[model samples]
Target: MIDAGALTRCRHRVHLDAAFPEQLAAAPEDPGVRQRQDAATAKREGIRRTLTEHAPDRWVQIDREQSARRRAEDTLAACAAGADRIWGAVLPLDRDVGRKAHCEILIRDTDRGGYIPVIVVNHKVTDPGRGAVTSGMFEWEPREDLARKPRGQARDQMRVAQVYRMLEQHGFASPALVAGAIGYGSDVIFVHDLTAILEDYDERFVDRLAIARGESATVPSKIGECRSCPWWPGCEEQLTQTHDVSLVASGSRADLLREAGCRTIDDLAAWDQEPIEDWPHGAFEDAVVTAKAWLAGAPLVRRYSQIRVTRADIEVDVDMESYQEHGAYLWGTLLNADGISVYRPFVSWDPLPTPDEARSFAEFWTWLMAEREAAALSGKTFAAYCYSRAAEDKWLLDSARRFVGTPGIPTEDEIREFIDSPQWVDIYQAVSDQFICPAGKGLKKIAPVAGFRWRDADASGEASMSWYREAVGYDGEPDLSQRERLLQYNEDDVIATKVLREWMSDRAESEIPLATDL
Candidate 1:
């Protein structure tokens, strides 16, 4: 299904890669040293020979000396009919097109500026023999045409129409928010990241959408969940009268008791003995007491903490790195209720693997946890975003579980309330959204936009970081100096997060309409 979206994403990858003069230019400094000189030479030479030999009469502009010209030519022949060629376009592709078939051609048109195009996409390093164009290109569509299609419909024609309709409906601002909200849902995040990747290369994706339609009814409804999810509150949803209560742990007791033929607490209390699953003892006394007191054969009201932390206990805004170094840092600003910072951003590093290294990292966590308890200094606890360098940090969870109590917390409501209230042990759930950004959610993309920027020269933003870790040097162990550098690198992320979160909250309140009527 060759469509605009697919092309756009490929185009985006190509365009983003354009910044790397180190990869494309022939001696970026010298101008003659295209990154892959040998590959370019071989490919150009092959093209020159093939074109010259195949159709002797065909005109050949032998600009082997000029890298841009060579690339331009390669791009031309790569397109259909090799007549109407394009340049400035191939720059947006996912493949780090090797010298093999990485050249492009340009053509001047009277109406538009110039058509930049895809070249020999089939020559991609990862997937062999599949040219960009031949491999299913996206189609162009009108906004009205697209709006009629349903989501999850992946047909090529339908996609073109759907994309146009979506673009017409959301435009940049709402789409961006939509993209963010989508990232909150795993399924939606996939779509957002995919669209971002595709939008870059495909010209069809860059079309101007109708702004009126962009502000469609669908925007608010879809975005509501992301904006209001209880998890980010350090507690996603509390038991509302209907949906909330049914969704809680205590609700499970209702089910259990009912199954045991003990619908009411009177039945439960008067039974000869409580069954194993009857919520035996101390399960839900308050609600039971309240219900028994009513004596109207009435139902009991179960309560669950629906707390949200406008503030935090240990506000550690985190970014994770899994390559050579498992790097992390903390921007823990323990503040008083009066907004005075007790402890500012604190950096920490961990190169330890295997949970057994608890001995080695105890000091690291102690310091981290100590910052959380900073409220002790002022008797004012805060909230935090609890995330880790690794996804499966069971030990981190276990540690929280182990130490969360010992303060005489007797009931699940108390535990839930304590965890959800302004005094949150961790704040990771709040920061890790359901969406995926093309550059990712790290400070590189997040920092500068929030009126702050990343510090440290070695700190390659998300793109470079991805290249550094995922592409090469992904060994479990990174350089010692690099490890420390990464930890410090993370500190800025936490700071960035704090800054960004507050900034965005303010902006949304001031700038956005915030009606959410869909």
Candidate 2:
């Protein structure tokens, strides 16, 4: 059956899953997905408990342990009995349309004389400002008394729409085109106006349905989602053998290049003509450079004659580790000054989403500021480096805001000032500006080229996420060894950034070939 998730998944994946199930390769185990599923289950249970506490006698819960058919039967019986709420309701599969849905909660709308779907998801659904209204924790109907903040979760909306369509088919949908979702770590029910989203949802569902029915082409293109896709190995093999343009260029760039008769890396490398329509000047040139570099098996090539890298007398490489959306639990810093280097880790052993997070973040911020002050006083220039400023800056501002009253936490303005200053160096941006990396520009991709390696062979942000869960005892008893492994992994990350910066400054110009030379 075409479940809600399938509607938003890779279209090629939907086709393969439906039409070529035997050809589907197994994707690597992603512990993060399991972690999120467990967390979502906990949140769903929490929401149900809260609802039960308020209106214990009004709710009917469908047993998830029961068979799907039995659960669907129970759900319809609950509706027939005019139950106020049905938790974990599995709708009967619609064979005609090949659609099925497992709703988190279905609340009976008394005024509309039918049920409305409520989806519980593992991410925030609101932006913390009033733009929408929601139901009371005890009530199902949207409350006029409350003005709640709301944000769009497209996936959640589409899921809700699918359930709504199922309800409509069975004559159980609420007349009002509305639904609600409970987001991660939130009590407020975020409501959605499904009417506005249904048209778009229907269009996507139709397209996916066509693909699943084997009525549409299922050409696989390398994309961000392919990293976790089960068909990746097969698709990568096909793309490599076919010399697909998408191997070197991505998204619209690949489409544009193909339209310009550059269908493969070889084609792109040879075509030195005018820029493709809608391409920014020099972007196509860079794409061609990427093609040539890819064909040459070069991980990276210089974009210009000289590579400029920022350095300081007192330089600090920083990396922060966070547990999902809980909090930044560890701030790993490598301080270098006067020919001496030391690694310092400000970490909270406490489980994330705890008050101790403030302590760890505050300590790191205080130490960093102290070092900056000391450097300035000694007439030494100072700079703090991170691979990418986006991830680090997000948490920096978020931490400052979340733990505002906590000791040692910087003000939002202070954090902003530091990030905006020249003293804050984003090494990733520097690499991107001076080089064209056909492989990628992530620290893990570029660091090895500079001869920097992680202590843990399997060191990766994804693997680190699983490590953090074990270190903090998310699954069961905490494994303290995982904590050390995580520290070493994080330490290696900060050092990788340091080594990358040094290599760009010292060796890149001579070792790397300029794009013009290619």
Candidate 3:
């Protein structure tokens, strides 16, 4: 059946899920997906309990342990009885469209005399603005009384829309055409105008339904979603064998290039015509260069005649470890000065979403600033490096803002000034400007070229995410061994940046071929 995810999932995946269910079942689910699903399930249950406790007499909860058919019967009965709240409600499937919805909650809309679907999701649904918010425990309506940022959780809105469709089929949809979502760990509900969402939602739903039903042909294209897709291996193999343009170009850009007659890597590399009007300036050229690099079997191509990286007498490589979106829990640093290198980690062992994180971050900032001050006192140039500026900069600013009055925590302006200064260098940006990484620009992908290897064979950001759960005792007793492993992994990451910087400085020009020459 077409679920909410089908609305947002890769088109190819939707086809595979429906037409080749057996293959999908054979393929192992991504560990991260499994973990997230489990967490979301727990969070949903917690929300149900919270709502029930607040208004036990008004809430009607269907037993999820029952079959889907039976759950739908009970849910409908509750709605017909004018129940104020219904949890774990499976709406009657829309056979015409083959759509179904397992709503987290259906709150009775007194004005509309029908139920409004509310989805409980495991991630933050709101950013930090005035949003249409309501209390989850009470009957909800769109209101701006609560402080909430309306982060457009498209999936959540689509999920509600899916349920709305099913509700319409059952003749129990709210006339107001609105829905709500409660983010995990939050007590407030963010409402959505179904009218505003249904236009785009309906268009995509029909398209997805056709693909799922085999009425439309589905072609695989590499996308950001492929990282977590079960069909990625087969799709990747097919794309590789066919020398698809997506191998060099990204997302829909590959499709656009294909439509523009550059259907494959060779075609793109050989194109000598005027730049495609659809492409941004220089992007098409970059794609052509990348295609050439790929054909030459060069993972990276130097963009210039000579490459240079910022170097200092006192160099610090920094890498921060965050536990999902909860908070940054670990700040790993590699300090090199006066012919000596030291690895230091400021870690908070406490479970994340805790105040202790502020303490750890504050300490790390204080220490780093002190080191920079010491370098100035010694009249030595100092520079701080991080592989990618995005993550580090995010936490630096976020931590400062989150823990405003906390001792030793730098102000957001101070953090911004540091990142904006020449003293703070993003090695990833340096790599991007100096080289074209056809494969990828991730540290794991490029560090090997520079002779830098992680001590742990399984070292990866994805692997670290799982290890973090164990280290922090998310399920049970904390695994101290995993904690040590994370520290080692973090240290290795910082060291890799240092190694990459040194390699770019001393060996890159002599070792790597330039793009123009290629």
Number of the predicted model whose TM-score against the real structure is largest: 3
RMSD of 1: 21.3
Kindly report which residue pairs in candidate 3 clash with one another. none
For each candidate in turn, the TM-score is 0.30, 0.94, 0.95
In TM-score terms, candidate 2 sits at 0.94
1 against 2, candidate with superior TM-score: 2
When superposed on Cα atoms, how far off is each prediction in RMSD?
A: 21.3, 2.4, 2.1
**Shift in Å, residue 204, candidate 3:** 2.3
Give the clashing pairs for model 2: none
Model 2 RMSD in angstroms: 2.4
Segments of candidate 3 deviating more than 4 angstroms: 129-139, 144-149, 184-187, 278-282
Off by over 4 Å in 2: 20-28, 128-135, 140-152, 279-282
| Residue-level lDDT for 162 in candidate 1 | 32
lDDT of 3 by residue, 241-298 (tens): 9889987886878878878877888998898999777684246678889999989998
Name the regions of candidate 1 deviating beyond 4 angstroms: 1-309, 312-357, 368-379, 386-447, 456-484, 504-507, 512-518
Question: Which candidate number would show the highest lDDT if scored against the true structure?
Answer: 3
Give the per-residue lDDT digits (tens) of candidate 1, residues 1-518. 12333332322223323333355343223221222243344444544454345445433343445675554444444333443323222222222211112223222222433222222211221211222111111111112221122233222322333332322322211122111111111111111123433343233433212111232121111112222222222222322222222122233454565565655434543445534444532444433333332333222121221212254433444343332222222223333335443434433333223332333234435554465567567665545543333332433433334434433213344334444455443323333331112222454554454477777753654323433332223445545555445555656656665665565445423422211210
